[model samples]
Target: MTHEEKRAWIRLIVAVIAYTAYVVVILRRAEGGPLPDVPYAAALLWTIGGAIAAAILAEIGMAIVNPRASRVIDVRDKEIGRFGDYTGQAFVAIGAVAAMLMAVAEWDRFWIANVIYLFFVLSAILGDVTKIILYRRSVPTW
Candidate 1:
């Protein structure tokens, strides 16, 4: 694969891993148990550490694979990114509408939150997949 393609795959893998970790953490928190009190300072430190680690790993991975090109995101990439953002927003809107309707109908369920989260994830995945498909099918520019 080209360096750019390899970098993209690496990024996708990292994103999947990070998101899976986040989901697992949330699930663990949801399980009924005596939760330890998290101090704000400790929580802030943890958040910062996680963010820094993730950012460093991502940057290093991309730099190692595609040092020059990794620093630049072209117009096509920006367009695809915008498309993804739009898809995410659409998912959020759909989830909000569903929640509102359910509330109006007096349906209360804890699983609704999970459904909304899944909707967002699925929407993002679909958007990325669609963008890749389009990129592959389109004619190349000179």
Candidate 2:
């Protein structure tokens, strides 16, 4: 696999891990388990802080392991990123509209939020997969 492909995989893995952690947290909260008796505000703050820290550390580690591989993305890379972003955004917009309609039709529920989140995650995965397929099929610009 190319360096870019490796990087994409790393990002995907990181996203999956983060989302899995989020799911676990939500499940725990729903189960009414004691979570150190921290205030909701404090928990939210800590989760955000931890996510940021984890992202920073992952980036640093990826760069350290692939210094030359990670530096300066080329034009094709930028194009792929743009395409993926646009695709993901389109999915999010569609998901939001569907969620709104569902809320009106069926009443708001936790499952609606979970469905939206799942849509977002699936969009991201599909976008990355599409980019990789394109890259593999097309000739390299460089």
Which 10 successive residues of model 2 have the least lDDT summed? Answer: 35-44
User: In order, what lDDT does every prediction score?
Assistant: 0.55, 0.66
Query: Residues 43-92, candidate 2, lDDT per residue (tens digit)?
Result: 44455466557766877787787777745678877877777667667778
> Candidate 1, which ten residues in sequence have the lowest lDDT sum?
35-44
TM-score of each: 0.53, 0.65
Per-prediction backbone clash count: 0, 0
- Model 2 CA RMSD to the hidden true structure, in angstroms: 5.2
Clashing pairs in 1: none
Candidate 1 lDDT tens digits, 1-142: 3333344444445445555665556556647653332122333334436645875687687677666664466777666556645655777788778877776776644445445555655555555554555456642354
lDDT winner: 2
Which has the greatest TM-score?
Answer: 2
